[model samples]
Target: MNGLCLVTGANGHLGNTLVRALLGQGHRVRAGVRDIGNHAPFAGLDCELVYAELLDSSALDKALEGVQVLFQVAAVFKHWARNPEAEIVEPNLVGTRRVLEAASRAGVQRVVYVSSVAAVGHDGTALDETHWNTESENAYYKSKILSEQAAWQCAEALGLNMVSVLPSAMVGPNAGSLTDTMGFLQTVRQRQMPFDPGFRFNFVDVRDVADGMIRAAEKGRAGQRYILANVRSSPLSDLIAAANTHTPGYRQPVSAPRWLLLGVAWLQERWARCVGKPAQLLLSQVRLFHNVAQEYDITKAKNELGFNPRSPEVALQQAFAYLYRQAHQPYEDLPQAAVQTVSSSRA
Candidate 1:
């Protein structure tokens, strides 16, 4: 498997990590990004950087040519949009279809579509790889579910070998603005936990997820979805505690009931609508947060793809260290013992 591999969304958090992982495995990687001019991240790396947008068919075809494996990681992820049909659904679903079609035409041997756990519908405490999130009204979650379905449909229609890896809440170094995982962490670090969102969900290190994506491409079954999630779920309070260990002067997070949070979310959504901006608190987010009783099952991934993720504590520490450095703090000021603990948990 030392052939050329194309990773879409190459500048993204997961995609950036995947590009590095693939390079480490001695594979020739073509980093597919929307802007080839933005080459700072891939600097000094032995990989080709190419411009490829998900909505652009010509770019997709060009990127797929001579590629043995395709890692479809580009998606429009956001809680709210001015026009979700154009900004979110069209790009995710239609762009996914375009990539699959181009891959089939180019005779790519394997494709690892990077989906999310949001695609897996939750039935109380029964959410797993088998569940499909068909009931979600959230644009981001719907895009993931429909885009994945489209990928499968294209694979079946063209007889292509495609596998999907669904990752849960991802945390680690290099989390960009695409998701709120790090933003929530920063909020806690700033002692800004005005109210507890009452959310508990699984989390996995982005590096572990990148490794899992490669493993899925190598060994996952065609048309099957593997959950690249953590074995444990961390609540907001627990995450704050974990951060407090590394962050100095961190305040413990406060709590609020689910009903009050829901009402606040509703008001926030209304305010966002009035101001023509995405809401920090959306009803869909609140609903999803409320549906986290059981952790997502990863036994299938472990048994089949040899996926074993580190604990959330390691991810939290890594994130804290990265953020601390990003804040222009001196390296000597960082918690050395905590950093060593995080480095040891990278297996």
Candidate 2:
């Protein structure tokens, strides 16, 4: 479980952070990427890089060879695709099965599978790991549920030790260009969202989630599922306030009725269809917001794996700074002195 660990999706938000965490712990990591040439971020690190596409099972055997533990983090994360079966469903289900099979062939000892909170359903109340997302029609949600189920079934059949960690929306400094958590903040920052649903959801720092996953691999029970997230769910208004605290004059959305939100989603979806792209806000997403707020209980993870997550507000501040830095924009509200204080304390 310690030597030559393989991490799939090496370039993604969570994957990149997990790779850094593993390297920091003096572990020899083989970064499994779809394209080795695209791994400029891991250039200076002394980790082996291999081309591994989950969709192409033949290549996975070589990638998993000589690896002790496997961190399966690669998957297609999209809400809506013109061809859901090809773009979303197949990639998650088939690719996950292929990875599990390859891991078995390579004689891997343990696997840390990355799932999502979307895969776990609720009954108009707080949810835990026991709840399965059975009634969800969202493609992304369905993919996660099916993929996680397949992983467990395959692991049991193959007798490979496996633990699944379901992370809520992740936000932190190292979020890549396409993270949904960061994208949600951007839509709010850019004044794109005209209204708020007033609903709340669990959010966790990307770094914390990465550490939690590693802890799961090290200390978690095999065949068990852990939920990695902040202790409390923050409302939409709380998120906006956190952003505004760091960036002055941030626009806050007014509360909108459910019908109005649905209408807006419909229009946006229609426009996206005409433009041959997915809508920024889909009807399914709107409907989810209309439902009661979702609270995640991470007590199991805390008690078992000792997984501790930072405050969502602190994570949001880091994300704001990251986005500003990436865009080469000066942080007028976050003064240099304050930035130095926060950075030093964080370090």
Candidate 3:
């Protein structure tokens, strides 16, 4: 299936990883970015950069011309959800609908929509693809739920091939925009422990998630959903311990009072909205951390798509390696033994 594959949001963390992976597999990738001039790093790479905004259906259709698979990777993810229906609805819900419409019109073979587990629920017995977030929670969650539902409905009625992959927390080697997962990892590495609720989170490497998405393009079942996650959930305490291995000045195993965190989370949320900054916490975010025992099922992905999410340690190593690379540190100069370990783990 070496067809022209259009990957939207190509300048994003997961999007960049996916484009590189698809290129490695000899797929002609038409990378859809909001701007083409900023793709300096991707200059020599084997990809076709097309300027497109999901809001512009015409540009979307142009990108999908002769395309076989479309990867919808762009979405506005924030801590405190936005108010005013337009602010929340346009990009996520409306944009997704537009993308689906374009894909359907162009006769695209299938689409692999990158979704989040948080889109399903704030708390539950580890929700699967079958579960969805309640509409009453907030705009962000509600938008994601609605977007997926619309995608499914449109896909079924139009006979458009579609599959969705939900990843809990995407970490490991990243490029392009900073994400919630990397933001937390960076804060923890800097010893910024705020209102520490020792809630657990299942993490999947970005490379692994990227691999799964590309695999979906070739092997995914139409109208199906897949959950990609590692073998276990890492509690905040253990995650901190693991993060310490990669960070130089990070404190190992830190905790803050739950009550203090509530106040801090609220203040952070308000400031985030006022200053156009990514918030550190929100009410839904607090609830998400409060429920510490939830988990998920990855057996379906393992059995169906041959997905194998990398272990936490391996993921962390690659993540740090990427960060350090971004800082202009030489990967070749790293300790030879560490390099060997990283290479071995990936293989």
Candidate 4:
């Protein structure tokens, strides 16, 4: 836990924050990225930047050299792509295998595979690490499930010590690009979403997830998985209300029935396919909202890894502030009165 740590996808939202966390803990880090020329994200950070394309064995070898811990965080996380098999699933599945194999070959002491709650299914009850998402049709969810499975298989085969951490919908500051979850929040804030489909999500701050990953590397049982998410699921309305409280004046979209939303999503997908672009509203997402419960049981993580996360409302407020700053808008801190109002409403 003391030697050089290599973080793949180091410029990503979670990866960047993880690197900062490691650095703050007085650990040397080798930031692995696809484009070494894009140093803007690592500006002023004292870490070695290496090119690490997950599929490239030579690149992985070079990046993993002398690294005691490896955080495999790179993946193609897209819900709707031109070809899900090629753009999403293949990279996630194959890339995970390649990274684990390379880490084993390079003699990395510990590996923390960054998985998602999408891999852990729900059944109208709070899900734990024991649950597996066996019914998701979403490409992104499928990729996470397959990739994590591959990671464990490869680790066991290679005798490598690896731990998997499944984080729920992550939202926090220092996002280099707008991820799908962040895009959803942005759409809601801008009133671009036509209506709320009553979707629920287990939200967590990216920083808390990063800390949880570190804990996994330090003390997690080999081949075990931990759920790093909020203790409870929150409705989309809660997120909207939080945004309204922090940054008011955006009109709220009316709630729509599930069937109506599904129909609209189908039409949107058709139009998107005809235009050769990614659909803003995916049918898989609608189906998931209708089927799976987003609640989670983080007791294992809490007791084992000492994972303590802030409230989802606080995460939403930070995300809203970050998004507003990204747009060059003046964002004032949530007033004490507004905070009281929002807290009372939630209670």
Candidate 5:
């Protein structure tokens, strides 16, 4: 309860929120940013910024000094960058190892690992802590699965306390003025969705995720993993409708045929490989689109960590409304395809 904490990837959307939450809780935070020169994100907040990379064991050791809890939440999307090994895997896995090793040596009390539902989900259907993703798909999922495995193994071997929080698609407002989901929501508000948003996925507010990590540090059992799933998940279609509530006539998810999604995936891979970037619709995202459904069993979190999130409809509204306010627009004429939009062909 009374020790300095450290968070990696402090410049990212989730990282920023976690940093703020830790500060609000009056915990001393040692924030590790890949780029220390850009001190702007941690500005006006009480935190320490250091240049730390996962591959650099010495640097990681330096940052972990005196840190009692380590919140490992840095993530990378393969499709967004040219090389996943350097961008996605190295920092994620190696960085995680460094943190865990340093924490073990420093005798840190707890480590709250922010893993993805993708790590525990496959063929979807609301997997639990017992399930794990198949490695035949995206490198991002592979990296997370591997990272969690390493963390767990290290926890067992070194007697380092660890708790893993597998969260759903994080759709919430963030610092740096952008979120990965913003593009999808923009598509919905501007009536630009080429396909229907008929899918279903759970929601866990980033704020809730932050709280869950704190809970994991305090009350979570060592060597345990918890799925931070929400109470409800909005139907993809209803999600679009929610956007229309504030925008006053937003487009909704159009049914993009299953086959069409496949074609998109194929094209996405080709395009990404050609340009040396990650495929936007990598196999895991597509598989998730096809497999993810059903309510996650979060009784463990509720009973143990006291984790609860707003309903799916409420969470989606929070996400879109925050994005809209930040954009200063009425959800009209969005410049990107973030979500499905109502077409001029709408009834």
Candidate 6:
């Protein structure tokens, strides 16, 4: 905790935010990315930028040379791919092992692995950090489970100090790319969703998740997993209501029956396959929404890491404002009132 910190995937949404948080705390940071040229996220930031591809062993070794804490935040998070094994699973599972091995070789003191709430099993009841997601059929969710498990195994074998943080659906500003969660917000804003699928998600701010990761790095126990999420799950209708409060013009989509949604998702998947693009909606996603609840208990994180996140409404409002600005005009061109709302939410 006393030395330099290396953040892999520094160009990503959470990773870039983590870098900013570390710098704000006066920690020397090494921002790692696959392409040093795509560093718009770290623009004007006081951090060392280095080329650190997860699969590139030599690059990782060089990146970890003077680093004491490693934030392994890089991974493939796509829900649909041409080849799930090669595109999603291998990169996550194998890349995690490679990065941890490199960290061990470099003698890094501690590591913080960014896992997802998808790795935690979801039943009808509220879930906690003790649960494992062994029932998920989604490729992305399975990858998180396998990768986190593999990371723990590798860390144990190499005698590396490591902890994992599982974040729920993240929403916040300054996202380098349009993530799936943000994309859902965009769809709602554009009135693209024909019908509400009755999906529920545990929303948290990306900045809060980054803060939780830092706390984990500083004080988390070795081999421990922390769930960084809101205490309760919010239905899609609630998100729609929040979005309407910020940007009033669109109405929430009508709720549809489960069978109707399943049919529509099947057709969407078929069309996606024919067009050689990822489906906007997948059958697995539809089924998961109906079968599992997104409720979680964060008592462990609060007691152990002092992790207290803001309300989901605040995060949703900020996300809607950010997406609106991106769609209509430049960030500087955003209305002063809207900008102030976002800035105040963070404060």
* Residue 109 CA displacement from its true place in model 5, Å: 1.9
Write candidate 5's Cα lDDT for 1-347 as tens digits: 68988888877777888888898989988877667766556656767777656666667777777888988876663435556677777667876777778778878888898888768764434456887777635667778888888888888888887889988777775646455455666666667767762457676677788888888889998888898867556566767767877877655545766677778877987798788765646544665565346457788888999988777777778887877776774323323322211111111
Score candidate 3 by TM-score against the native: 0.87
Candidate No. with top TM-score: 6
Cα lDDT, all candidates = 0.79, 0.79, 0.73, 0.84, 0.72, 0.84
* Candidate 3 minimal-lDDT segment of 10 residues: 338-347
lDDT of 6 by residue, 244-323 (tens): 88667667778889899889889988898789899988888987886356889899999999999999988888888888
Clashing pairs in 4: none
TM-scores, all candidates, are 0.90, 0.91, 0.87, 0.92, 0.86, 0.93
Instruction: Tell me model 2's lDDT, rounded to 2 decimals.
Output: 0.79
Native-vs-model 4 lDDT? 0.84
Residue range 1-347, candidate 1, lDDT tens digits = 66889999987888988988998899989888876655555655677777777777777777777999999998876768868778888889999998888898889999999889889855446466988877557888888888888888889999999999999878776554436777777777777788767777677889999999999988999889999887667777677777777766655556777788789888988888799987877778777777364367889999999999888888777776676666663232322221001011111
lDDT of 4 by residue, 1-347 (tens): 88999999988989989998998899998888887766667766777888888988878887888889999998887799878888999999999999999999899999999999889976558889998988658889899988898888899999998899999999987788889888888887776777767788888999999999999999899989999999777777777777887677766577788889789889988998799888987888888875345888999999999999999989888888788777773223312221000011100
As a TM-score, model 1 comes out at 0.90
**Span of ten consecutive residues with least summed lDDT in model 1:** 338-347
Across residues 6-49, which tens digit of lDDT does each residue of candidate 2 receive?
89998788887888889889998888877666545564566777
Model 6 TM-score (2 dp): 0.93
For model 3 the local lDDT of residue 221 reads 89
How do the residues 188-245 of candidate 3 rate in per-residue lDDT, one tens digit apiece?
6567774456667777798899999887777888878898876567766666666556
Between candidates 2 and 3, the one scoring higher on lDDT is 2
